[model samples]
Target: MDPAKLSNAIENVHRAGMPGLFAEVRDGDEVWRGAAGVADLSTGRPVTADMRHRVGSITKTFTAAAVLHLVDGGEIGLDAPVGRYLPELVPGERGDAITVRMLINHTSGLGEYLPYAYPSLRAFPDLAECRPQSLDDHRLTRFDSTELIEMGVTAPAAGAPGGTPGLYSNTNYLLLGQLLERVTGVAAEKYITQNVIERAGLQDTEFPDGPQINGPHSRAYEAFFGMIDPPRDYSVFDMSYAGPSASLISTVADLNRFFGLLLAGEIVHPSSLARMQRTVPIVSQEGKVIEYGLGLYPMEAAGGGIFWGHGGTTWGAGALSMIRGDGGRRMSVAMNLQRWNTLDASGRPQPHPIDDALAALYRVAMSG
Candidate 1:
């Protein structure tokens, strides 16, 4: 790898307005790690390669791996209706029609709970007197999965169960988390930690049970909808609201290790891993074309080829982990800022700084 090119990529991320960013790349026996910007803007603490960050939806990959592990063990059937495991949680009719496969592949058509749970203060009659911010006051409150599911269950369904195109809803994985517990008699966190984290030997990865990140971590900051005067310190918010959907915290090294091992067929059985790579085209709400597999995503590599992994976004953090399919090359990127959208007046997303940063990083990481 060219050091100059790699350094330029890291600098590009900083220039994109990310307070801090870190990344790890692995090709065969060679490993490259880099960090730029401040981990804590207040203290001017620079980000380091080993610093942990909230890897939002990337947690879905772990959750999906756990679910697939159950499938491999015959404890759970992929084609079986999720209602078979948690009948009381899902809507009576819709639950019966949705299969575990649909949930993992994001074809369940379930609504997201966050919007309902934290609607704009102006929209909620009872909270009209409260601040306009959605999650400001509830940041520290521990939420129950059941209540969160109920919020989705009551919201308008995105489409008929398994009949619509891929709709990325955290509700799908939230229910899967409940299903994992129902099947294995273990919490989703424990199952994933044992099956995925431990299996991959990710020493710095964990499913934190509280608001605080236990080890060395970047202070997460969020400009909620870009409305907050200054980005709020959301590094300490209770992750229960995100639960099995987006609660995993990890470092770039650990993330790279996990994805590397996962694609190498060490995390799940070959057959199960193959199934996880089967994907469906998904156009994100922002109109980006994504191909989502069971818990993984196929990103078009800069040098031509597919890199499989997932990207995650929490309120104050963002993460990306991808491994080339043809070779074992892997890269993981993390940022300490969230809601960093640059939208036009029509609310359409324009390319943000992270896009340029990621493109630069990918060019270097995937280069031979």
Candidate 2:
């Protein structure tokens, strides 16, 4: 891979509308890091390669690996029902049917609780109605995971348990968090921090205890599907609502090390890694079809090659970390902007330069 070409791709993202972005690529022992645009548009602070950023749903991969670590040690069962562990949270008929496997793969049929939690953004499948009140109101609110899970479980099931074309739901991951606490005798975040992050030797990765990120980082900006006239900075926000599902603060270098180790069986046992790659069809929040495994997904690259990783976004921060199937090449990127597209008259997202730039960036990052 050409570092100059990769660097040019990142610069294009900013020129094409991204507020800021930082990325790292690994081709064997050689490494390249690049950053573009201003991190804080107001202060004009530039982004850097080593800065910590909220990596959103990539946290799910950590949670899933920690759970599967228990499986490797015979502390948990892959197919065991969550109700067996947290009956009070899951309970009754519904709990009995959905297995741990289903939760990891988002096939448990639980509906997403986001719409209920953020009533202002409840008009799902319709980005045109997006608003920022709930996000603003609860910026520092520490949410109880159980309360959040109940909002999802009690609402309705998107499909039957083990059904094909599963719906992606954060509720399932919240339940897994509860299960982690029950089995580990510690909070899910703590267990994952110890077992996964520490084990991966990722010094720059951690689950935040509160709203503030402890080190240097970019100011995250959210557009709310272009409802917010000017994208608002949400750099400091409580992540309890996302819990073990989405709240991870990390850097690009650490992400590369972690995902690389994960694919090489240095973290979970090879057998468990196999299960993590066993995919099922999932209908994402935006109604896009993605092949999801435990927490990782198999992404088909430009040349029909496969890369395993996850992409995630919070109010204003987003990231994607991916490693080639052979573990020979890797890419991890963190961005300061989220949902930058404006909605069209038909309530569909109008194409923006950011999308094309990002698509081009990934192609270059993954190419040889």
Candidate 3:
């Protein structure tokens, strides 16, 4: 691949007000790794490939793998009703019928009930409506997992038949996190760290206890719901605020390493990995796109190739991790700017540089 085109592409994305963009492509050896823009706009610290950004639901893949490992070991059964493992969280009648497999596949039909889904119900009303708070602020970093669970459990469900067959909810994974801990007798973070992260050797990656984003890294900011330009500072809004389902931080290189090992059958058993990727039909704007697999998403790429990976977006950060169908090549990108415009007729969004960056990165990586 031409280095000039790559540089130009990165430059264009940087100019669009993203704090920075970093990408790493792996093919037997790490290839074409680069970073651009400042980690902190105020301090003018240049972005580096090592700086961490939250990976969002990509963390789901790890959670799913942990559950499957237990399934493969005969400690848990995918077909067994979830109530057998977590009776408290599972409703009586519905609990007996819903299996663990349904939760991983988004076939559980549990409504997504994120407390942050509504701006009005926030725990700290003053902090809730504020645009983007600086990470340095004391009131913001105080957010933690306990508060997250409290808000989540009380939030309303998306539908009635809790585990019917067609809805995606973070609560399913949250429940999975709790179940994994129950079966293993270890916290979910430690279980995944020992079985997944440490096994894969991801040095810079971490799953903090709550939603804290304290580190020597880029300052995360977001484009508010109605705003166009990126806000000055959102550091005050920590991943700790979202807890496990949404709070994982990592770098492009670390993410690429983790996903590469995952698909290569290094961290998970082959049979279990196979079960994690099985697709199911679901309702969509179009007739029906593919529903989620275990922890990953199996989607058709812009260039007409099916890839397994996941994308995570918080208020400010956006993460993309993908492994080609063959699982031999992978590409990962992490950006600090979040843009919300819809893709045009060609499935392209120009003003939002992420769309272009994603397309070009996909083209080059998928070419192999």
* Full-model lDDT for every candidate: 0.82, 0.92, 0.68
Instruction: Please provide, for model 3 over 251-308, each residue's C-alpha lDDT reduced to its tens digit, 9 standing for 90 to 100.
Output: 8888888888788787789888887787765443122455667777786666577788
Using all chains and alpha carbons, the TM-scores for the candidates as numbered come to 0.94, 0.98, 0.83
TM-score of 2: 0.98
lDDT of 1 at 163: 60
Model 3 TM-score, 2 decimals: 0.83
Cα error of candidate 3 at position 179, Å: 0.4
lDDT of 2 by residue, 206-290 (tens): 9988899989999999987787768999999999989999999999999999999999999999999999999999999878988
Q: How does candidate 2 score on lDDT?
A: 0.92
**Residue 288 accuracy (lDDT) in model 3:** 47
| Each model's total of backbone clashes | 0, 0, 6
> If both were scored by TM-score, which would come out higher, candidate 1 or candidate 3?
1
Model 1 earns a TM-score of 0.94
Worst 10 residues of 1 by lDDT: 123-132
Could you tell me which 10 consecutive residues in candidate 3 have the lowest summed lDDT?
A: 124-133
Residue lDDT tens for model 1, 1-368: 77678888888879888888888888888888899999888899898998888999999999999999889999999999888888899758877899999999888878777777776643322322324366677888888999999987787877777764677888889999999889878898998888888888889889887999998889888864456557877888889988889999999888888887787778889899999989886545444557788989888876688889888888788898888995488888998887666446654446776777768777788764
